[model samples]
Target: MKKLIINADDFGYSRGVNYGIIDSHQQGVLTSTTFMTNMPGAEHAVELANQNPDLGVGVHLVLTCDRPLLDTHKTIVDANGDFRKLGFYKGAFTIDYEEVYDEWKAQIEKFLSFGLEPTHLDSHHHINSFGDIPEVFLKLAKEYNLPVRNNMDITEDIKTTDSFSYLIETALKDDQSLNELFESNQTVEVMSHPAYLDKKLMDTSSFTYPRIDEVEFLTHPRIIELIDARSDIQLSTFKDI
Candidate 1:
């Protein structure tokens, strides 16, 4: 059987996006969500996770946008101590690897402080794969015995994983066209940003309107029917692996 993990990224991004993530889990096909530690609606997302323990919650390690919660002098952040979205690409700026590792470890610790164990770990904007970050997260995953997303593979210490496929960004057609997802014998993680558009999301980032539409597509009846028809496809969570 093909196991599919329908995980929504950016939980705790904002209240509106948080609501959409929960809505997808409760009313749609969403099976898991990853949380941003120091984002605006982090506590709310934790509350929602407590209320719905069936939905797997994982840490979404962040490096951009929010202010650094661990250190004040990290070069990754700007003059105001907030992460700069600009110089985030590879080889853009020299980075302090140890400082970044500590900051990321703190993010995971922040998530654990809520009295819940994370099922897996992934990064916000997939930052763990960029510029001296692969080792930091891999080390923590081994220390904590958790699964880091497949975006960065460090070795046997890190568990093997399947990378998530974005429905809209990829050429996979629409949300109902889910047949292509389970073509592999191995587990597959389908990543999505299913959310309602709100003023807060619009003001903060350019990734807004598509999320609003994704909520509609994910909750459609046809998608559910498609799943039911496939005896080979099994809906799953990250912890199931």
Candidate 2:
């Protein structure tokens, strides 16, 4: 069987995001979520996870656009200790990776302290796309004995989106270690931001409502509900296989 972990990204960016994630998990197809430790409602998201017991929670490492956990004057997006913007799609920025590594380690430590031994790690903005950062992510994952989302979907459906397909293809080419992880049979987290068209989300971001709707109806919800809610459905965390 092809096992899948339907994940939701940006768990703590806003109250609306948090609400949407939890509601999607409870009422829709979301089986896992990645949390932004420094985002707006992180604590509440954790609390909800504790209550639900079935939601898989992982750290969504924020390195671009969003503020850093560590205060550094000369880093990429850190301008006087706050994030330069709220999105990273603009362009890749350069940073001193050596200094950033120390801060990244601390953030992981903080997440673990909250009783979430993350099963995997993924960057906030796919910042892993940058040079050497993917190496940092691999090192961190190995150190923690966790998985970094390998993003190896080669099936025909994934090819429909050229950008997404290209991302997966590049990951497959660059990530040799993921070969074993692929064979190990543990689920890799795959996420999408699908939502109803509403004033709340529309006013906040330029995310196309039409695309969101396409994902909502396209993702296999019935299968997800059956699998996630199965009494055989053992609760899974980032650390659980």
Candidate 3:
């Protein structure tokens, strides 16, 4: 059987986003989600997770687009205490791995403090996949006995999810083509952002994203029809495997 891990990212972004993610799991195909510990809506996300334990929770570890959980001063962020734009930072690659490791540990500990045992680890803007940063996550994963998202391409032994764009495209594609295309693959993991964007979300993100549309697409009756028509594919959570 083909397994699919349908996960919604950014669980603790805003009220609209948090509620939308919960709605996706409750009324649609979302099986898992990753939380941002330092975001504004984290406590609310924790409450939602408590109400729904079956929705596998993971740490959406932040490395950009926000301040760190722990301090790195100028090493990771500017004097103004904000991270540089993703493109500028990606181009520089001047990061202190040890500082990064310490910050990630703090984030994970915050999750644990909330009594959540994360099923996996992934990063904001996928900074963990950038050069040399995978080592930090791998080390922490081993230390914590958690699975790191296969952003580093270690493969076969690591946990992972497919890109958000690819998953959205496939979901919005003609159903006739998707079923035939999936006939060959035994498993697929779809990463997604199924949310109702709030002004807070707009303020945090650099560009306006189509979150409401994505949620609509994920919960649409056509998606249900496509999934039911393919007996070979089973919707699964990360912990289910």
Best by lDDT: 1
* CA-lDDT, candidates in order: 0.78, 0.57, 0.76
Q: What TM-score, over all chains together, does every model reach?
A: 0.91, 0.69, 0.89
**Candidate 3, 1-241: lDDT as tens digits:** 7667777888897788898899888877778899999888899999999999889899998878677777655677778887656785567578777888888899999999999889988788888878788778778877776765544665455545442223555643666655554556545557788788788888878634677777777787877677767776788766755
Q: Which regions of candidate 2 are displaced past 4 Å?
A: 84-93, 152-189, 194-204, 208-241
lDDT, candidate 2, 2-51, per-residue tens: 24455667766666667667776776656677878876567877787787
Better candidate by TM-score, 2 or 3: 3
- Screening candidate 2 with a backbone cut-off below 3 angstroms (N, C-alpha, C), the clashing residue pairs are 119-238, 119-239, 230-233
Global lDDT for candidate 3? 0.76
Candidate 3 TM-score to native: 0.89
The order of the candidates by TM-score, greatest first, is: 1, 3, 2
Our tally of clashes for model 1 stands at 0
Ranking by lDDT: 1, 3, 2
Candidate with maximal TM-score: 1
* RMSD of candidate 1 to true structure, Å: 2.2
Cα RMSD (angstroms) for every candidate in the order listed: 2.2, 8.3, 2.3
